[model samples]
Target: MPSSWLAALEDEASKVLPAVFFEYFRQGSGDSVASTDAAAAWDRYRLVPRVLNDVRDVDLTGSFLGTPASLPIGVAPTTLQRAADPAGEAAMARACAGSGVPMVLSSNASTPFAEVAATGVRWWLQAYLPEERLLAVPMLEAAVASGAGAIVLTVDTPVVAAKRDGDGPSALTQVPPEWLRVNLGDAADAPKARDLGVRDIAWLRELTGLPVVVKGVLHPEDALRAADAGAAAVWVSNHGGRQLARAASTAGCLPGVVEALGGAVEVYVDGGVRDPMSALSALALGADGIFLGRSPLFALSVGGEDGVRRLFSEYADGLTEALRLAGSADVGDVRGLEVREF
Candidate 1:
């Protein structure tokens, strides 16, 4: 894990990840528009800095759904980390452990659960809705036995949003066979949520003894809906601008969610989170924590473990600077300040 690894990973991503992922991960129309929007919207966002306060110690530690992570920053779980390195999830897990951050382990991950848990990082499991109940149960069991502290039941997809090229028809051929072949018992043809909801997850919460954080929340009504259904946390995200296009910025949607969740649940925000300033703004707006999704992948694709490490390091350092400059000593410190929205 050399200090220079991130630069290398970014270089690699420029060549490989874009072409392959654009086909496999990106959606057409609104989805494709969202990708361009993500780049432009993130570029236009600037942090309003504060000054002249006794800012000696800046603490970024916080907990999401009872798990104590090192900083306010953590990984947001994209797909195909293996495409970047053989170590894949293990490399990312080790980097999180080294940085004292938590990581969301995706159901789409090529690395097995036990291998990820063995890294001693705080493992948070994510499960795509399996079309069949039979396939879903065992993986839920895996999260408990494998030592996952929380289950992030993702709620965004009702169907795989089709790339404009195929229009909801089978585009599986477009996915390289070399990138195929992995599973948690028929994880192939994984179900795209027939009707995702809170009741569907209550049993999972009961089974795991770990908190369940529902991801993909955008509406305040949905936030209320999830808390009522028994989620310990609500993650406001647009699936990294890949799942849906022209979606409201997750940061732009947190306050209404916070108002809806009231005081009973933790609220997290993700999407278009490209830097510490954006993260700081989300936290100040009402998010208890923020999720770092694509940047690390960008980091991983360029350099491997070291690249991910540098990405987290830069984010953590930049966040601490944000806190100090904001006249806030910790994540909680920013809450009392009045935000000036333009």
Candidate 2:
């Protein structure tokens, strides 16, 4: 919309990809008001840049779930990545590996965990527990065996919300069933457990022996509950407004989630974090890390692995510039940077 390269890429991708596929990646549930309003929500926060401090040589290096990363940004898990490119999640893994960043692989990934792990990227596995919790075990076990560093249990999607019907068939209809759930194999059709509770956090930890990041948390109380239940982190998300309509933006929910955790556990956020300024704002509000969802998918569609690499490069450059301008030498300095709602 604003003539940025990212905007141009989105345009290019829409033209190249199938209409249903593009719509699947871009659309939200119901009337789509929540998805439409998400990015703008970040704009309400006015950054108060500090003056008279050494601003040269800003660093963007950070860690996710105790693992070192080259940048504060990580790729959020998006389902059916192959819809964007033939290489799909493997290409994303390669790009993230090359950039020294982490990636969260979707439970419903088109590619298998072994192939993604072969890229050597620091990665976490995203899973939705089935009504029969054991139905998720084999997949989770395989992911861990393939080098998944953490388990990101997506807690929001108990049931996939109804998307507004598009002009043609849905994207999933176009994709082969085999390509949609390579991880789950025969159990791919199992329903997500609607009765998910905080106990599932410990269950996942015991099952995988990996730190569990409870994703899809919006309320501070939910964040606290996850922390108390032994969650290593609380991710602020509304499933990109796909799970629920009119949900609060992650940018709006982040501060409260962080404050509720009170530094006891890590806090991460995704949704509508399109630029460096928004990313810095999240850090200032005490977020331990920031993630990108559709942005990376858009980039993947435009240039395969290279497109994704270029996108991360732009973010790194932009974030460095933002940090220096805000008088911060590294990401840590932005932890409590001043912000005001405009």
Candidate 3:
């Protein structure tokens, strides 16, 4: 079951957004088994709370790639935000800035990097390297010039995955091309590089002079390789189950990736993180931080900037309550809490 607050927000979004647009944001590739199972996977772990420790004060403040964040949560990259609201990525950026959390802008974002950075949110730019790596040079250059804190290279999508039809008309077809990727300009149709390798990690880092975080890693060996390739962090994801139909959920894959890195680099996870328990579950399982994909869009659909702010507030409150109940005063202490897989 999804958290009541999140379910309510989603229900509200369904009423507010066009059926096609809503379906586009909600649907995953192929049979949808991975997308459907992503959230439920986190519920399989049982957290053993410690007692007798004082939890008078709980601090949610943390950092992502060494940049301070008010919370350990971030807004994961999603495409075509204009489909959600007129303010689009700018609205999301403002909310993230107000809440003092980080937001990762998508390569397909409707808003430009400079516009997002102007909001003063600690932001990272996500990219899908094209077949000719130079094709991404302009986008990357713009990101660095706009003061992006890091570069998040999405590794799962060599090519766009096939989505199951009949989820109303595709949002891609419904939204105008101009509203889809304002950042790419004329190169909007650039194809993603299918030959991504470990060397690409160093290439991005050296090129941008920003810490590179490799997203969409599930296998421990792959995570280790990314670390050896000098990734500042490895994000455990399956592209929110939009890439592979039966890929393992990030929740299921996080521990192995964490163990593989052995504190060599930061680890983050996304997909199906609906509530405080799910967020805490990821941390107790060894994730340095957690992110929300659909939930933030749902919030945007309902109340634009304020909706996102409220969503973050709810998570912060819920996390504080959970930490108090578990007798942990801070996020780092939550990592020491025991988690058992059933």
- Cα lDDT tens digits, model 3, 222-307, are 99999999999999999888989999988889989989889999999999898888999998989888889999999999999999
Which rank order by lDDT, best down to worst?
Answer: 3, 2, 1
Q: Report the CA-based lDDT of candidate 1 relative to the real structure.
A: 0.73
Off by over 4 Å in 3: 1-3
User: Candidate 1 regions off by >4 Å?
Assistant: 1-12, 16-18, 21-31, 39-52, 164-183
Worst 10 residues of 2 by lDDT: 1-10
Q: lDDT at 101 for candidate 2?
A: 92
Residue 6, candidate 3: alpha-carbon lDDT:
65
CA RMSD per model (angstroms): 3.9, 1.3, 1.3
Residue 318 lDDT in candidate 1 = 82
lDDT of 1 by residue, 226-283 (tens): 8998888989887766666666767567778987877689899877676677777777
Q: Candidate 1 at 108: error in angstroms?
A: 1.5
Q: Residue 178 error for model 2, in Å?
A: 0.6
List the candidates' TM-scores in order.
Answer: 0.87, 0.97, 0.97
Q: Write the residue-wise lDDT of candidate 2 on 4-89 in tens digits.
A: 87657768889888888889999999989889899999989988888898877777888898878889889999987888889999
Hey, what RMSD does candidate 2 come out at?
1.3
Global lDDT of each model? Answer: 0.73, 0.89, 0.89
